[model samples]
Target chain A: MEFNFPPGLILVLGAIALPFLKGKIQQALIVLLPVMTLVLVWWIPNDYTLVLSFLDYQLSPVNSTPTGRLFASIFCIMTFAGGIYAMGQAKILELTAAYVYAGSAIGVTFCGDLISLFIFWEIMALGSTMVLWAAGSQSAYRASFRYLMIHLLGGVVLMAGIILHVHTTGSTDFTAMQPDNLASILILVGFLVNAGAPPLSAWIADAYPEASPSGMVFLSAFTTKTAVYALLVGFPGATILIYIGLYMVFYGIIYALLENDMRRILAYSIVNQVGFMVCAIGIGTELALNGAAAHAFAHIIYKALLLMSAGSVLMMTGKRKCTDLGGLFQSMPQTAINGIIGALAISSFPFTSGFVTKSLETAAAASQGMVAVWFLLIAASAGVFLHAGIKFPWFVFFQKDSGQRPPDPPGNMRFSMWGFSFLCIAIGLFPGPLYRLLPYPVEYQPYTASHLVTQFQLLLFAGFAFFVMLPLMKRTLTISLDFDWFYRRFLHIFAKEFTVKTSNTHIRIEHAIHQRIERFIKRLYRHHGPHGILARTWPSGGMVLWVAIMLAGILLTSALL
Target chain B: MISDQDKHWFYRSSSLPKLWMIQVFILVIALVPEFVLHHHPHFQENGVLVDATFGFTAWYGFLSCAAMVIAAKILGIFLKRKDSYYDE
Candidate 1:
């Protein structure tokens, strides 16, 4: 316990060697790296953890708490699943970055001190941005830049908060606390911004869609879920998060409804799904936090599955717009079916992974006697089916025939899809394994008759509403405005035109003032300018008289004023 | 009425009525849980009255979706723009 190596560092540092290995060697390394990390992560118990010293401060580098193990286990599983899916398809550069990104997420899960957390957090930002930039398209590059800016700002704010928090409390332990003080509030803002909370929730939808096909699968897994992990550890039971999480839940659905790109619809659903987890965290009970944790695990599987299915379509057809994709179920049945499982799981259809996990949050809400929250969560559950469960599949696979008969993607892609598809059903059918891994002990059962009946009625009727009101729910070739409107359009345009005009006016007025000042200066130059009498060399007697005269004149002016 | 020749079996217009029938059956079956099961309220609140009804979830699901769709359509008036809106 005196000294121990972090499991994440193995995968992250292993990424440096990724470009060197090729074909079988690279594939072996890719799969083996996570396996090795998983072994290392669990090999040490919670008691056998290490603390290091640097510059009079103690830093806990490897924290193997129950919650940390749960997150790391899921992250390692996701990385492996996503890796298998992206095998031989994604660019070597993107794979390398993804490995680093995922490893950093695992690192964050195990990090015990704010110092180690901040470092791992930054590495995640760098690694994820690299994954996006590896998309190699112009728009992907631009999106990654915007994504980096937001994360960096979040990192800086978090760093400052950590510094202030440590200075005030004389400890760097990362734990739950209300954001009552400035440092904690700043820290909360930092965490919320990353959680895709408010104003910046748009970043998930904005950046995730721009990645390369398989690249999006990896992109969807790590970053925000890691933020959910951070929030669960740092701000459990914080009241403001309830409002933030609720806002994100609805915001994601409404935006997804207006979206035309199929992948973007899935991306928006990521925000929506993550919103459920965030709300649960805000509920802040042991059951609620466990719900958040379990939901994050389930969301990773299903969201990645959805993105993988969409990515398969995009790769096969070379078109991402929903208007251009339909009747895919005929040709790419597996892909379509896989996408449907993901959709059902995401919408929390009974016996799906989401059903097992998200219901925990709803139950938590109910237990707390928060009637409105329970109602809204139920509505959001239905809305989940309405927008993602129905809209995504209907537009892509079952709508008016676009007549595009693209085949399913490569073998690895198919295998990956099947694997995640299996996990979704397996988890849904028996949530015991996931529940046992949760931070808290479990007595909650997902298969109660009341819960099952209520969930079915809610989902099916939402399906009915979707078809009955099909015209209103028609997909348009359009995008909707979000809070990023300020940075993306409004503030950008204002900074462009408004600042230019103001600067121009100031320059013009300064020039006019200079012209007027020159006249007075010219008049004075006759007496005191460089070429005037004051500029000319003077005798000692004249100098003394002039000094006396100037002093007398200055005294007279002061007296008069 | 899509006449595209390469269309799948599911896409054939002849299957429309069956699909509709299936959907209607699904809606009908949704009420079974309400009729047979004792719907437990999370908060045990007796006064709100929504949970007490047999088919309240089905109705609530439909109405909430309807409200959301209507809200989205209204908001679309101001927020929806061409897909290339952010391109510039």
Candidate 2:
């Protein structure tokens, strides 16, 4: 089917009039915008390609594939939920920016061609950066700038790839590709950058936690997940993604295991969870792809829930480190319970959202006889329980009492958390509806006795490992080194030292030149001094005598010569 | 010098053995899954017992956690820093 207005534009245009509206009405409009967009998303038919001819090329701006629709649905849902969560506390500008961000992400997801995708992609980056900067802290400001630079770099790489791709093939379709050309490889690199993939995966952990509590709800839902959607649509089955995904998985676990900040731990787990989806995408089987898609959906809910719980803690107590937070369950029982639900959901614990979803990825790997991949995935599964599943809630809400008695946050925050917590369990219990939304046929059972037994053993044992190793896993006031060191410190230091030395050398050279010029002037002044002979004014007689002598001497010298 | 008087029930030292008992009970429950489920070997009939072995995942999970912790400690020797590592 064809369309006149893009579904996501409702939010984009709706946000323009937000400033003119007052408090309660303004909040109503903000929440309504996404709800309207969500209705429009479902109302539109699948593969609703909106084609326009521009510059002799057919550009499809709105091409709603099943995967696109699925992601957009969640994005819209997230925007609605996050809007509700952010209202009353967050500045209207952040709310506006977040809606714009979610709109563009929806635009990118449903976008059919490279040009439109790039446009929406850039918007996502700008919008998210605004959300980060809206946190209004010095570190948050710095983190926002760093976050923007990395995403812009990813954007440029993606743009170059898109241009090359469209130029060579003479097509702008945003669909899957074989990594056979430099264009595709560059494109994959660009997509991987956003997917929180290796060598640069540190950006997610570094910048995401710095966002304001409400800002994080928006931040967590978009950006990386949109990239995950991009990988799903464009680069699925690329074998390299398998390794990149694996690296991100372990990288997140290891870093999170060593993390101290409450939100930062969740941030690290974002990379890790994205790693699971990327790995499933790498496996590239229909079931594996389904696994990736479902996991992303499940992940967004639980991850956002976890962040909300942590954000509530941050909002109420103004502290985020595990070293400073504990026994919040004493007063914040609801927050603790919700956070634990999020934690269990993240761990893919039995009868939670992750259980119904993440198992498909492992099942796909196992069925394929990818022995090593299967083993590593199982290990990562357990590792998830160890670091994120157990550590986040245990440290934040249930560890030794820090005597901080912050009450649960306001109604909006609690409502959203409860909503998400409900969805997490509901999806886990009744995955059939979610399963039906997948692009592929669904026949996988999440509650196979063997699978249940295996997951329970893995998770329970991981929990046991946590308590047993509690002493070693104690929180500290230290930040673990990651690849970000190269940018945040190493490159920063290198640039600082280089400028210092270069300026020093530059000053020395300039000083030396000045000294030489001074000496030359001094010597000339000495020779030509007024008191010296050549410089002296002579009397008439003396001048005539000297002239006669000089003339005679010159004449004799000439004759001799 | 922290007092235990105002601690929550979950935090009380008297509750420690009960918590451990509950954990062991959960471990026992975890063991019961293998007894009923006709477990499938992950790869093949002749394949090694990666997924099929009783509590294989448990041991792997525990060992992996231990290894990661140890590795992180070693890594901390070189990479860990005061939180003041980046202030500006």
Candidate 3:
């Protein structure tokens, strides 16, 4: 269908206007914007494309491929659910920034060229960082600065890659990119950083938990998923991503297991979840790509649901650590049930959303005879259950009571949780509709005896392992060592020590020079005062001798030259 | 006595019955396709059975769980300190 107005753009503008509306009107606008975006997303025709010609390149601002539509649809749904969750909170700025963030993520999906994607990418960085800043704590401010530094660095890499790619290919059209050139590799590095790939993956855990409870819900949805969208569009078949993704999956679980902060654990799991999608994209078959896209779609829903549940507990208890939280399920049943659904879904338990979407990746690996990759992927799946799927719910909801009985979150929060929980189960039960929305045709089925039995054995055994090792899983107050220590502690200490040492050296040098000057002055004073020949001088004789000596020195220098 | 009971079921207790119930529930769900939905497309083909029986899901699941559990256990050996480990 040919459209006159940009529906996505209109929804974004409406979201920007929401916080200004005041009271219930703001809430209405919050819900209305995402629903409106979803409608706009559906209304756009599958084949319809919009392109604008720049100086030497063409930029498509509106593209409606099934892949783009699927991501945009889920992003819109996230904004809607996030809006409902954050409705009664006092931080309007965070609410606005979140919409802008979500909108730009949708913008990234619809973008058909490199420049357009870059523009939306930076906008998401700025908007999400603002949400972090809106958390209204000193630590949040510091963490947001670090967060901004990483994203800006990523943006610089992305921009440089795009410029090089355009210079090389004479085209900026966002299409399936093969890593044959330096430019594409650079672009992939940029995308991998945002996708929470290793080495740089520490940024997510370090910064996200510092955000406001509602702010984190928004933080969880946009940035990494947009990177996944970029990867799907740009470098689908890059072989190296398979190993990189595998590293991230295990890295997330291990560090999360070591973490005490509830939100940090979830933040780590985002990397873990996105790793699966990245691995799927790396596989690059039609089924694998579909699995990646569908998982991203399903992931945003369930992950947000999971974050919202954690956020609710943080909101009620004023605690964000596992050691400080427990037995909340008794009072917050709605939150508890919804959280359990999210946990189950993330674990890939049957009748949950994860079961349908995640299985496709494993199936893809097997189909390709990538035995090692498939093995690692399955192990990561079980690890996912161990760390996030079961650990999160068990520790946060059902562990030893901390004797703090906070009431359930507000009605709006409950409603939002219920809404996302329903979506998680509904999609799991009916995978057909989701499958149809994928970019490719769907033929793979999720339910079968062997599939069930094996998935069961794996997950159940993983649970058994969890309980068996419960003694080792006890929460502690210590922060796990991550790559951030290089910046947060080591470099910081090195800088401090260097400053002190250099300043002390400067003081020593100044003192020595001062003493030398003082000694010289004292000698000069003593000589000139009463004790020296000059002090007792016959003035004419002294002047004559001094003049003769100066002449002699000048004459000697001239002779030497 | 009440405190002991609380510790038994809720905290320190093994509660094998609850664990078994969870297992049974998982097994029933896992076997649903074979017994009840026998006509399902996934089962109509032998790929699913071969893939499952040949250690696709079982191996993947067990190995992943084992890796995580082992890692946690190993880390706990060194990393798990008293609740006040960092306080000093």
Instruction: Encode model 3's per-residue lDDT on A1-561: one tens digit a residue.
Output: 456444456555776797668877877788788898889888888867787787767888888788899999888888888888898773988988888888888989888789988998998899999999999998899899999999999999999999999998888888998888889988998998899897899999989999998999889988999999999989888898888888888888988888888889899999999999999899999999999999888889888998999999999889988998887787788888998899889989888889999999888987787867876787888888889888998889888877677898999889999999998999999999999999999998898765666677678768867776788777877677667767776888899999999999999999999999999999998888777767885679889999999999999999999
TM-score of 1: 0.90
Q: Candidate 3: where are CA atoms >4 Å away?
A: A1-8, A501-561, B1-63, B75-88
Could you give the candidate ranking by lDDT, starting with the highest? 2, 1, 3
lDDT of 1 at A553: 100
The model with the greater TM-score, 1 or 2, is: 2
Structural similarity to truth (TM-score) of each candidate? 0.90, 0.92, 0.85
What are the per-model DockQ values? Answer: 0.66, 0.64, 0.33
Docking class of 1: medium
lDDT of 3 by residue, B1-88 (tens): 3465555355545665676678668645654444433322233233444333433454456556766767766775665444343223
Ranking by TM-score: 2, 1, 3
Error of 2 at A254 (Å): 0.7
Best by TM-score: 2
**lDDT value for model 1:** 0.88
Clashing pairs in model 1? none
Higher lDDT: candidate 1 or 3? 1
Runs of candidate 1 exceeding 4 Å displacement: A1-3, A502-561, B1-6
Model 1's A-chain: what TM-score? 0.89
Candidate 3: TM-score of chain A is 0.89
Docking class of 2: medium
| Pairs that collide, model 2 | none
